[model samples]
Target chain A: MSAQPNPTLSVALEHVEELARGLGESGDALALRERARDLVTPLVLPDRARHLWRYTNPERFVPVADPTVLAPVAIAHEWPREDDLAAAALIAGGALRMVEIDDTARRAGVVIEDLHRAATDGLLGSLVPPEHGFAEAINTAAWHGGVLVRVPAGVELEHPIRVRCVASAEPVSVPRVLVVAGAGSAFELVEGHVGGGVPALVLGVTEIAVGPDARVRYSLVQRWDAGVTGHLTARARLERGAHFQMSLASFGGSLYKADVGAVLAGEGAQAEMFGVSMGGEKQHMDHHTEHLHEARKTHSNLDFKVALTGAARSAYTGMIRIAHDAGGSEAYQVNRNLLLSEDARAESIPELEILTDDVRCSHGATVAPLDEEQVFYLKSRGLPHFQAMRLIVYGFLGQTLQRLPATTRERIEALVASRLHEE
Target chain B: MTDSTNAVFSCADVHIWVGEKEVVKGVDLTVMPGEIHAIMGPNGSGKSTLANGLMGHPLYTVEGRLTLAGEDVSALSADEKARKGMFLAFQYPVAIPGVTVASFLRAAVSARRGAEVPIRDFRKELLARMADLDMDTAFAGRYLNDGFSGGEKKRVEILQMLMLQPRFALLDETDSGLDIDALKVVSKGINAASTPEVGMVLVTHYQRLLNYVRPHVVHVFMDGRIVRSGGPELALELEERGYDWLEPAAAAGGA
Candidate 1:
């Protein structure tokens, strides 16, 4: 295990094969997993100074392998009411337990199926970048089961599709999901990640595809337990005239690192990404955002914010890359960090690689203690110390929170406010 | 006379320092109930410094004593002084993005009262205050002071003063940047808050705001000292004669 490279850490092919054997899958998935493991073995591990794993060690996310068939644990989850959802998926112990679709969506030719069957039919690993990263490669080789949602062309779904994933398997749980938005269709997805307590790891990945003229909104809210180590990747590809809006909010996990990105694959594609992260206690969080412009006349905007209290720390990296032939593209990125305690720390790095002419690209990053003047202003209004700081933090996160579904926004706001008091 | 214990608010030999500079060199002031004391000064005369220091801004180190309604408040924080009936309308209010004016005022009002204000009463009063200042009620829903015009920011400060209803109000250049129409409305809001139980101190460089909200006494403040104190006509005198007449006296440390 110690001889393994840093990229895949100690997770070798034996671990991958062990998990695959437990899944009891045959043929096609076998070929993909084998191919993924081979791709990982010979590849050079990414250096922290080079990219990605600067603040976190990848080995911490690689848990001990149970090497047995995944059986469900007695963990509990409260999913949104069926009436409020176009469809819902439940994944437990690295296997899809249920996929429920509304009659309206069924009539509109929307398809929601188990990821195992989709991969059996060779649908897995199609949209996620093949050379995504080392952790993603391990996920590709060892991921057991999840869900896939396909919205047919020209169909507009009124309700959001919700996916709930729980890490019931001991030590390590790898969950994956795929989403397809057909041409001229409108799709909204909300993913809720929970479970996995002390001494557990949940390596999750989600891939999204937006067809031409499709409009999609994807929101992933992560609430892993305090002792869990999480490595997550979620990325999307946009076609011609497609619009994608994503909200990523992180609140829990002992140590977590996430890679969220989008590739503009067609002309006139637009992606608007927003992030809200608050860390407390001894938690450590690292986030990386990527926007790749592969087509002309594309546009992308990103705003990611972090606030930390206690001895918590966070690192944020934002990258905007415009391909050589991709002209007339516009990209903007902004990152803000607020430190509530003297011991809390934050680091922000913004990188932009513009290769073409006639493109507009700008990036900004700011790190500061909560504005003293603002806190004093709120305090002078008669609020006590904690209430004043709470109000400031609330307002700081309010912009991105306003972009979320009202109910979810309220829930997260309450959770964040309560956590502020706790700290 | 201020030692009589009947004064609404008073500060004795108060000196304020912003780092190495002593902006407000030892000064004494007293405000009787319902009486407005106008501290008129030039741009750098430290009038704002005095107001902010009296309100206990942490950046300014204050020496001497401050009493609000006969309760010593020199050791209290800004919020503590607020709950004890003190408020300062800033010369330049800071922008707090994403905090709506309505919600900010609600929290402040609740803090002042030491309890949450009822929603019905809060909304009703907020709208009423906004209307009194010639501000659209929609303004309450906007982020506080974010991208607000100069006049709008001044008006919101006065609106907040009205909402908090502090016993000792410090209007620090609250009249600056306000046009005649806005000046009139803001002055009206100030006058409405000046009751027998309240004392007011108006800090400004110009007398235009005095036309609508008359001050009972005017102090010619220069070089951090009060060079002259007199009746309301003192403001007119300073406006007509300018401040150079008393420059020597102020620079010499006192009237």
Candidate 2:
């Protein structure tokens, strides 16, 4: 793509450059800044013509003026104790505020620190290539608050680590996370987003690397307020005998787009992706996911469910691609959507591209309203209409939630129940 | 028939319509507190439609008066009617995936009593009911009617009837798809639920179920109206002959 001289995009790009300049040049940070400068010119804004941007408009999330000029607002730490999360880190006002790691995890060689410091140590920007998409490019260039988590070899943490990013009236917040699970390591990570109901733009990305024989469970919960527009992207690479599972629960944001992809890059690698999204009251949520099988004896499974009410809308597209040399690979994808209101709508698309005939691959997608028979069944059992609908929706989304850890599942169930009541 | 004042469930000139087409013509029936009334009909004779309409299905427009224990309930929704001690066992029980049978039963029982039952008491009651129905305790954790066999669904429906203790129950084609063993098990559950305080209306196509749970009153339904009324011998006579023998009389009556 050639560079375009659009005034609005130019202003945003210049602001990103100015933010990069302020971070100071040091080791990997300097190299990343230079790369970001070169990439901004060719990174054109996405439009509806592209399938990835078909359901959303990128220009709406791009700030017209210099975002760096806005002053930071103080934000309080309000993590819920009921979640029982092991460790947590906070990012607010475009900076890393605090990080808390459990003593056991710290003693077991688990490292959780600022991404800039990791970048200075030449430990950033290697997993996620900068040229993948506009969001990634912008995040690489102007990321304000970022974190890196590394679990050394043979270390198994019993509790889940949570990283929360809250936007406190910032015009633009670019948050990033990089996770590396060393060989034979096992752990779980939970990433969350919360907004202050300001008309801000958030561009975020998370990169994961699961080493040989490592197992990782990662979840991303997006709960931005209705005033924010968010674009979140994630990518993961799994080595030999590595098992990785990732889930996303999206309940907030006026305009949200998420692209999460995983690649089984070595033999015996396994990956599973599951998600549940509830959209209501004129909200727009677009989700696209991919599973890439690049080695023999690799397996992947994906299941996503969405429930829409009021005038909300959602679009989901899933792709499974198997390389030519990847034989004995098994892949499955299923997407189901429930429309709870006449005005609510959803679209599901499941695609598969298999280059070899020696693989088992299947995909299915469905968009349907709440079954009247099921609703009447509940009503006949003395449940009111709203309660009947709620039960059915919870049942529909529970298929995905049941796959998470017990604590995570309970927390998400509570979040989803509250969201349903609010609508 | 007993006095109308003592009737637990009563209906008068009830007509059910789906859109503009009336499915159940004008019909009148009444059942005392300890009575079982069986309504036998041919296919497409509006047996199930009548049962659903009487339960206040939103799709059908029900006209005329319906009463439960001498109170007018003609305008109540299905849930409201259910809370007021009315229940309908569906012909085709819907499979609600991810909702455990135990949880659904608990919610229904709670709604009926207007208070949440303590977990210990609820579990005890559920286990006792399941044992009575010969159902495995593990079935309680499974999704409500999801992937359950035909007999299992009917048994669960009866289990709900026993748990909720509705004053009146309507069973619609509950015996349609079942083997002899399953039918007997389901019939045992139904018989166990038939107490003196709870009246019942069984809508069926066959008299086989009546042999297990004999009814005090039998009504022959045709073309959405009751063509004839008699006692238990009527079911045996219809079984000996056939519903074809009554079509002529029904047609003349309609004219």
TM-score of each: 0.93, 0.96
DockQ of prediction 2: 0.80
Which portions of model 2 miss their true places by more than 4 Å? A1-11, A15-27, A67-72, A80-86, A119-123
Best by lDDT: 2
RMSD of each: 2.9, 2.0
By TM-score, the best candidate is 2
Clashing pairs in 1: none
lDDT of 2 by residue, B1-255 (tens): 546787889999899999999989988999888899999999999989999999988789999899998888999989998999999999999999988998888888998889999989999999999998889999999999989988899989988998988889999998989888878888888888789988899999999999899899999999999999999999999999989999997898784
Candidate 2 C-alpha lDDT tens digits along A1-423: 433546555535555445655654355575575576467664467646657777777777665544444355677767665554456788888887888887888888788888766642353666566777766776777777888889899998888988888866777888888888899999899888987556878888889989999999999889988878888888889999999999888988888999998889999999998899999999999999989999999999998999999999999988899999999999999999999999999988777889999999888888999898888888888989988898899889987899987767877899889988986
Q: Evaluated on chain B only, what are the TM-scores of all the candidate structures, in order?
A: 0.97, 0.97
Error of 1 at A3 (Å): 12
Alpha-carbon runs more than 4 Å astray in model 1: A1-9, A15-26, A42-44, A66-83, A119-121, B251-255
Predicted model with the maximum DockQ: 2
